[model samples]
Target: MKRITTDELRAMAGREGLIIQGCGGDLTELVNGINDMLTQEGILQNGDAFKDVSVFEYDGCTNLLFSMENVDLNIGKLAMWRLQSHETFGGTWLSDYLPNRLGVDMDQPPAQKEKPDCALIGQDGNIFNLIGIASRTLKENGLGEQAKEMRERIIASGSYDKALCIIGEYVNITSAEDAQEQDCGFEMGQSY
Candidate 1:
């Protein structure tokens, strides 16, 4: 298998309209996961492995995107695996099991019962996006109040960067309304 640099990954993200954040890891595991899915489906010759993986930097975080062309499966299991493995929440054994258990043939045309092409990942790895696991962590660590305050602060900041900083630090605040106002140039709901 070959490895591609973060810059290459970023270029692909630009072309594909995907946003990636946070530090990137070896990505080999993610690649392998996809290869496994593809092998099981008999898309390529069995035992074929990923040839390239890459990461990119965006905003304040790094993003990863890779391609394993000539993949046997119809829709591309590597893409599916990367999405499932990287998402911050809702990726359970059931989620993984259901796709394989249903035995939907990748080569066959889409059927009513077949799983759809999809990719699921967290928006910011924040509590709101990961309520199930984050809530439990907050409760267990006695951070309920802190978590609530941080949420408010983030909403109030109206500055994506500020909110991201606070969320990154897991900081607490009284209210988002109290955050100092700043002109982010873009109107509300505008993409950054």
Candidate 2:
């Protein structure tokens, strides 16, 4: 993990060969997440000198490229996916990716005319899985080869899809509960 400035990221995009693309929300959040991870790892120094990270909109999402040298691609991918998921899930044409596994209609027709809330492009190639990162993190933190094996089991069991379904259910339940709470408050006020 290494904290890189916007200029450094751009230069890396130019030189090495890693690509990071995000659609919707603030790109600074993504940069900060990476920087924070790096900083936690003691790879980044404290100060404004390294805070120049930024992302430029390209195609539909903001794209930033960097080198993958000494970087864990799995963690990076998960971080991006989780962030975008938080931002765009439940929006039109931006439903959870996991529901697709359950034969749910997650994809919109090209002629439908609604833009997705978020889209991600990975230059390292499209084997997107946040679980992969979790597995890798486990291994990195001392689970060793067993961590890798468990990650494979998760992928095989379609944990990613199940995770998405669970997340959607949680969000729906939470929203409903919040609405009920608000209605209850309103009724109490009226009674008073």
Candidate 3:
């Protein structure tokens, strides 16, 4: 799959387009999820608004994006949704084409830039299985396509360490010992 370069993403900022976060699953399912999310939030009343949105891979993140060339959408509502939900499933828009109706800057990054953490220790020692686990985690969190790309990149990685490095780019790795400690506590606390 072709990767969207950061430069290309920067160029997109001027267009009246959007890059929504927290979208995952199969392409079709993700699109549905996007529509559901928007509809639940009362951003839109219909599901067809996101039919043209596609999975856009940028900066190791899988985002649902509406590029300039994409079918026209209610970008005004989407921009407001991004601002209103700044604390949840946060997203940003390409500001160059933005109408500035919200009075907030779209080019600025959020308060936090932390990547989500994925437990790595105590996982299957095999690289492929590790990739599967990481991919599943990502998918559950709305990064389905990023997970696919991570899997492919890890497979092509020359060594296990290199694969781990690639994985780290997408998520923070929790140590095995820490996982074991937590699991031990959970087991001890179990009533059964």
Q: Who wins the lDDT comparison? A: 3
Supply the TM-score for candidate 3. Answer: 0.38
Q: Please give, for residues 1-192, the per-residue lDDT of candidate 3 as tens digits.
A: 123544344433334456666555675765666667877776665444554354556446676665433243455776787788766655666563232422334565423324556788777878888787788777555455578789888888879999989998988888666667576776444664
Q: Tens digits of per-residue lDDT for model 2 on 56-95?
A: 4433545543333334435454445445554443111112
TM-score of each: 0.28, 0.23, 0.38
Give the candidates in order of lDDT, highest first: 3, 1, 2
Global local distance difference test of model 2: 0.38
Q: Which window of 10 residues has the lowest lDDT sum in candidate 2?
A: 112-121
Q: Please report the candidate that would top TM-score against the real structure.
A: 3
- Per-residue error at 98 for model 1, in Å? 30
Q: Among all windows of ten consecutive residues in candidate 3, which has the lowest summed lDDT?
A: 96-105
How far is each candidate from the true structure, as Cα RMSD in Å? Answer: 19.8, 21.6, 12.3
Give the whole-model CA lDDT for all candidates, comma-separated: 0.41, 0.38, 0.61
Ranking by TM-score: 3, 1, 2
Model 3 residue 34 lDDT score: 60
Model 2 residue 84 distance off true place after TM-score fit, in angstroms: 17
State residue 174's C-alpha deviation in candidate 2, in Å. 61
Task: In angstroms, give how far residue 180 of model 1 lies from its true place.
Answer: 55
Give the 10-residue window scoring lowest on summed lDDT in candidate 1.
111-120
lDDT, candidate 2, at 101: 17
